[model samples]
Target: MASYFSRRTIDFLLYEVFDATALTRYPHFEAHDRETFAMSLDSVTHIADTLMYPYYREVDRHAPELRQGRVSVHPKVRDMLRALGEAGLIGANFSFEHGGQQLPELVNACLGYILTAANNSMLYTGLTSGAANLINAFGTPDLQSTYVAKLLAGQWQGTMALTEPQAGSSLSDITSTAEPQPDGTYRIMGQKVFISAGDHDAVDNVVHLLLARIAGAPKGTRGISLFVVPKYRLEPSGELTDNDVTSTGIYHKLGQRGTPAMHLVLGERGDCHGWLVGEPHRGLSYMFQMMNEARIAVGITGAGIASAAYYASLAYAKERPQSRRLNEKNQLDAPQTPIINHPDVRRMLLFQKAVVEGSLSLLLESARLADLAHVAEGEAKENYRLLLELLTPVAKTFPTEQGVRSVSEGLQVLGGYGYTEDFPLEQMYRDIRITPIYEGTTGIQAQDLLGRKVPMGGGKALQLLLAEMTQTAQQARTHEALVPYADKLEAEIERLRTVTGALLPYAQRGDTERFLMDATLYMELFGLVVVAWQWLKQGEVAQQVLSTRPPEGDELAFYESKVHTMKYFFHYEVPKTLALATRLTDPEVLTIASEKQVLM
Candidate 1:
């Protein structure tokens, strides 16, 4: 069987670096310990290996097609969804009352990492889980009772239908109209585009957590309302009927072709029904509840695909012998050495390792904070919430933007074969390219990080983050080998602070255009520093293991590799922040809108 993921590295992050078992001390997660976590992981691994991974190529080879106003997907999608639902993994993080196993988000994040690494094209359940959770949180009792159970059971597919033909990212300009009826439901009429899992034959029905503007409502985002629109509506008599949701077209994409991205038309015949979620004119707020979850999910998907690529490249390097070592070029009769022995190949592998592992560590750390934000109270809860809000964009942006580059590097390790269909790198490279564009593009995420998150609450979140990074650096000081890397992280934090100080003045002066002119570069700088902190944290744990309970053979190599990769990140990746900071703090304005000149 193909090893798409690394269990040892997962264990190192969960048990050693992040100390996930410690989360069980909280009342909400008290039922979970290491054993239950392992049980959930093992269950997903088995299903992923047996059902999903084997069909990775088959699913992509046959993309979904739209015919006769219906969409058809691969046959394996149904079987995969059923297996996941039966495993109780669709709602892994929900409470017992909501028909979930009450698993920690940390563990759930790991579950997603495993599944996506196996076969990302079969991504169906995570969307359902996110949509269902929104219903459970803000919908009426009738809405929850009507939708959550079947959705979790994989009997139905759930999607977030927010993007429309007129409004892509600008939710303020959406023209979708929702007229009220005496029956308390609204008549929805609009066209939505690029809706994933939007319409497919893999499930009995599909539900959309849609957003629309009610008649005579306020303008912009505040006027929007959330609605539950279904492909097949249920009547009071328990019969199903078509809801006037038509599949106008299906998008043929570059990758992740297994799930259908549909162009949907509502009220084509003027007979669409949508039940309101939460209060009217609060749709964007309600949808953000799911959008945030989707963002983190996107980050995990990026890391997962990059991880699979890394493993593929590592295995190929170990087995494929090509050239002799630099020092052995004179030995004409000697056999060629494995590619892994070549210095250039090893450098590429280390870069891949540094990106894949570092991205996962940062994602899991964000997940841990999410779990804390869920259960803690008062000041602790508020602090965790702030920290999560601060890291969400970074967690979303770095893994994806860097994952794309990392997967490309992985492809380079395979030489000519990597570009062909014989290996998975070609497909993986295409698959990971969409992650930075998913949820929100890197530019959008960057604006959020610098314009909103950094300055919010008088900058308490950034202060909290810097203090935490400082604590990690102090802990690493106990080990002599980690001190240099720890010191580098400390310097990076100061650089981040300096850059923020320089940019905040424009924001403070209400120059919105200038304030966000270079926000994307600031985001890149911030991501490097934040990931450096994660590496330092991992290095500290690895150093402790070596000092206290050192082992031989593969075990020693594992811990040593952790420390080595930490140095690799500091030496190779962290220095890029210098150029980014210089650009951010520079007294230059090149991209701002201007009326003085026009050039073709």
Candidate 2:
């Protein structure tokens, strides 16, 4: 199958939109250059295509099997993960002091898209390893020395244990207890569910970053504490010891089946030991450190899924010969043309193209912000942080939502064959479903964006975002094709600010439910406006390229296609978001009293 990620798009986004090469000016990333990053990404892309993707269908057909309290992965998949670790691609974002290459996070994000597209299930083991490495970064020195190297090297795996039976998205409602023991370790007693890669055969042990309550620490969210609970005890010589933690059962899930959905029992025998990551009763704060990273990770997963489906459909469309074009069908036996010749098929492909590529642009931009947040100095760092926070929810939600839609459309492109396992679309649909639900659900992310993230840092982040959009609008004034689109974008931004300001008093009163409900609409509006900005940026890049005659015929068509797609985005997506902004302005509630039982 043809790769959906356009090298041209990558070039345009990195150099033209983001000036990615200039990141080398920062002392933190001076060790690398654009050529090195490109080479690394090329290597990852090869591994993804040759090894990871080859087993995607096989692993799906043969998921993890649990017996005797142990989850077993296919040996081939396990070996592949080990090979990825051996190649040192697992810790692409960590610092060199931690045995990583110290590549920029943007570069890693680009490389991650390849891995995810290849086989998302197998990628979890590596993803968790990176997450653990991050946790160790912000954690104590003891924690880093003990687990950081192993996680980065992929000798051990890690999982985030947040959800409990009673504590769905409401972490404040959690009741898990962590009692401090005399040996400086806490005895953790809790049941964590829906924990991905929680227990698997590939790694020798699993380290769970669990959230639980310390005794008499208050109630609700304030009392929570983050614990580093390893599946086994570590010896002084840096080897595994029996810790008595066990996987009671694993869930038979709908997608991403190659990885296990674990139900874990921590210290069931009153022996599970946990070391605190930070201060007591400060667990939620620390866990959020991981959550923010996971948010971007989730967005990348969604984009990767969409890219895979788009590539599959695009390949199918170019190769599958169907009925002749309407104008040429009069000759009783006119030769059949590729499905791309059909206007409706072209529409579907174009829609998929705009959505997947647009989502890719947004995701990579978020990653660029991540890198900027780290290496960028002074105002540049602060500005990038604002951009990162402002787009986090959109980055996470839009791709998942659009990915699901694109996979469905891809299935439609395949007709009857799409419904069966004979084609990859059905599995793609199944796999993409979990992205929105995992890391955080769309509703949860929406609430985070509007109710929390928007107001965070006194809305400096949001203002910074508005300033960038305004600057873009200023730049677009001279371009006839882009001016109207930029104007519409500015208008929507104003509308959002006005509606959000109007709701501030209610928001301040802790009437958070209504605020969050309206915030959902705000999130959708934000995604539409933000992606439109990306599309407009792409239009600017393509416009310049098209101004000069391209040396190659295909190169000119590719650039023109990008310009045409960006126009499609402005006309189709931006207008609809204006309605959502208007809806957010209304001070209506969706409480039980507002609707009849029949409607409910």
Candidate 3:
């Protein structure tokens, strides 16, 4: 049997469905083809199997600890980081000029899916890659020369240090200050909590892409600036000096204990040196660039964890025979049946399958758009950008919010053993609970989708997304088996429009609270429709394969399974939009805050 995830499914989504090879037509990816993509995937898969999966439990059992003012993680953390960097996967999507393979984001996203599924606690490279990319994109040549190479090579760890004790998600309220000096560097003074991989001793230095406010800067988010604050500063004399960044404490988290989430204190000695990355007071905008990428990565994390949980449960259900089927209750004397034969168990399995695969499909779609956004020009680029922005919040929220439920259901399939530490489900349940809260919480994502992205460019993003969904629905109409699902998706789109039309007037009238009260529900409805589009797109590909190639054995089952899951999403998940639509359009308001209280 294979591991928790399925490579065949990845191949189906990449080659058959998304046509990732076609991306090679662009000059940025011209040197690569399917062979190169497969090489990258195989390389990461091997590394994950050898260096990551084996330590999934070992790392969790021995979580990172802060002793003697030093944060020490599992020894394998160093090995894994070195392996990923040596493999050129840390900066996989970067250009060859910057020491990367110039692989498409699509391929990089698949690599993330594979690695996270194997052992999510080894979530080190993505942070490093993101931080390195920021430097590559906006840092000065001197800064890039000093930091990018070591960071990407895994000799140094990279972190996004944005959260503070005072400001968690509200960047506008951040009080971290960076004061200018005659030498052009700023003195950084602040404390950041929940900083992942912030102060690990596995690497020689930890580079923080931190956010702070310059002296005499305006209030709110407009005053924030981005800085490169390293744990160990490199002097012109080539001597490494402490930059006054200290590890105050380490958080004992519910899961993902392999990576240290540290409480860091900067400028305790008032000697923390910080170099500006791009510009002052544009930190929020600059961070948004990485934040969007991180959001998609978070979505993949949720989906990957759920995929592992689903396979674990599926394997257990097949092997652990405990109950008789409803139709075979009297045949208990004959033999015990596999729980998979039970209707309720089967429903749970389908739910997991639908969520895990559908979420992956949607994430891949977003990744493909990201790739296009990178290579495209003119309106093509704008369209890709808008669509990516529109789908990002939904992509981040849906898998996480629903992934938590899906993992819980996967645990239910194993009954008592799932709850025990003897099995992986308990850890998986704890691990996935953080996804919804990562990058941004579900409520924040909903607000982003509705409040910002939905109205951006005068609603062009939403319109373009609907057009794409319609195009997919049109293609799906060719298969008789898919027509009903396609029609259902189209209807959902219209209902979404009706609900949006109802809500926008409130936003127009400056009644933001009233308008966005049910934004999370809107996000739910929108995510369902978007994933329905992904499933239909997949079904279209599967139908073509079944009609044209007619694969046999596992191949045949794979395509058929895609169609089955597409139907499952439509039948089981798509109808939830009804209540969401009603709530979005209902005249009565229950959540909006008012001067007069009614709850008492």
Candidate 4:
């Protein structure tokens, strides 16, 4: 089988670009070192290669079926979850007190990339880890003891049950009701849709980190409260009984079929019980912790599937010879050349490579900032947190939006063979389609970026991010070979400032709709500049390596490829900012509907 990902590239980003080991200097991560991090990665990679990659096709072919009520998934899913749970890969980023390895998000994010690249259909443990971590962070001691261990061990499946039939993305309109009971446990009555891994026979139980509203609370977001609603209620008699959470329906999706997307019903019989997490009316804030983490996780999923697609396409292009070179086409005696030799094919492959690695670099940088936000002190901690918030939407949006395009391009690389199931490219193409819509839709994330994140804290976060990009450009300027790209990145930084400066006034004028009108376009523009910054960071590191102790063979090729791809991104992708900025600053309004104009 062809390789789906490159560990050499992962190491280059983690050690050389991010300096992940430096995180160990902080007391929280002091218990860990490069050796332990390597062990964790190696163990996860073993599980992925043996259990995940080999079944990538088989699992998708044999999607889960919902019968009567039970969700019957491919049997391999159970083994994959078990192995991951046993290896502690699920909660590897959690604290040691919670039975975790306390690894940095930097390394944890890398493991997520490897697993998803191998087989995203077997995506089960991530939900468990996210749900369990929320419980440990906000749930009471009893709640933690009851749910955290089983979830971390992968003995129970965990899911976020937020979307309702009525509310959709408008959480403020959610109607899921929780009534206080004499027994101290509230009764839950609601239906949740698109609940991934919500109900599966792969584990002993299904735990939902569900959202509901209490009686007589404040309206809108302030009224929301989180609950731990389980498929089976643990009775004092030491046995599991039906908790009335039912798998009302199962969705047949375009791809990632190995994991079931469920529609769940709670309290059909009115016996459903839910325990509150954290405080009443504070559920949304607590859930944001998990939601934000899942956003980055979604980006990793995009990057992973794209990486797999790129490799699949790369393998085919190298081996499949089709036509003679354009110059030699008239020479009938000439042999057909491999498609990789074609300029168009090379362009497509280079675009894929640039997106995959650039997305990885940005995501890894976000992960490092998260680590510092968690462990650093005072102003440094606040700065890291703000910087993380600023980049979070971009980190989530770029890999996914660009990843969708890259995978489609990968399919194009194989001609007609790519459209058929005989190749994995078609499935990868399907699987990555949901990422932009996952965690948050591209529009939702874009609104969050411009409407909220940019103007947040008087634009401190934006200022910090600009500072970071400027530093990267300055470093790139030091190496004569990288000066041109450094200028390109610096130019983008200024363009970003000008564009953001242009847009912020609408918000200041109190025109919320006008301010966020082309927010999605703004997101696209923002993604290009930030990714160019990531590329320059990579270029600076590779330039330093090539200048000093560059090794021979693959290592040398790897570093040179980094610099080359960085140049490709600066040349081809960064120029997109000009078009986006032009549209963003234009005074004419087209999208907003006016009541005076009523024709469809």
- The true-versus-predicted C-alpha distance at residue 317 of model 2, in Å, is 1.2
**For residues 299-399, what per-residue lDDT tens digits would candidate 4 score against the true structure?**
99999999999999999999999989888889888889999999999999999999999999999999999999999889999999999999999999999
lDDT of 1 at 310: 95
Error of 4 at 103 (Å): 0.6
**Candidate 1 overall Cα lDDT vs. reference?**
0.93
Superposed on all Cα atoms, the candidates' RMSDs to the truth, in angstroms, are 0.9, 2.2, 1.1, 0.9
Where does candidate 3 stray beyond 4 Å? 598-600
Q: How would you encode candidate 3's per-residue C-alpha lDDT over 1-600 as one tens digit per residue?
A: 247799999998899888999999999999999999999999999988899888887889999989988988999899888988898989999999998999988888899999999999978888898999999999999999999889889899988999999889988999989999999999999999999999887899999999999999999999999999999999999878999999989999999888899999999999999999898899989988889889999999999999999999999989988757777778858788899988889899999999999999999899999999989999999999999999999989988889999999999999999999999999999888899999889999999999999999999999999999999999888888788988998999899999999999999999999888988899999998888888899889999899888999988998899899888889999989999898888898777767775677
lDDT of the candidates, in the order given: 0.93, 0.80, 0.91, 0.93
Query: How accurate locally is residue 243 in candidate 4, as Cα lDDT from 0 to 100?
Result: 97
- State the displacement of the C-alpha of residue 132, model 3, in Å, after optimal TM-score superposition: 0.5
Candidate 4: residue pairs that collide: none
Query: Model 1 over residues 1-600: C-alpha lDDT tens digits?
Result: 877789999999999888899999999999999999999999999999988999988889989988898889999899889988998999999999999999989899999999999999988999999999999999999999999999999989999999988779998989999999999999999999999999999899999999999999999999999999999999999998999999989888999998899999999999999999999999999999899999999999999999999999999999998868899999988999899999888889998899889999999999999999998999999999999999999999998999999899899999999999999999999999999999999999999999999999999999999999999999999999888888899999999999999989998899999999988999899999999999999989988999999989999999999999989899999999999988888897878868864555
Off by over 4 Å in 4: 596-599
| Residue 223's lDDT in candidate 3 | 93
lDDT preference between candidates 1 and 2, better one: 1
Model 2 lDDT tens row, 1-600? 457456676666777777778888888889888888887878877777777888878989899988998889877765666666777778877777777788887778777777788788775654565456656656788888888767766677888899998888899988888999997889888889888888887887788888999989888899999888889879779777767677888888788888888888877788888888878998888887788778778888888887888888888889999888988888658779998889888778777888888888898888888888887679888888887987988999998887788788888888888889988888988998999887778888888888878889899888888887778777766677777777877887787688778777778998776667666677778888888878877877777667655546878888888889988888777788768866777655554245353463
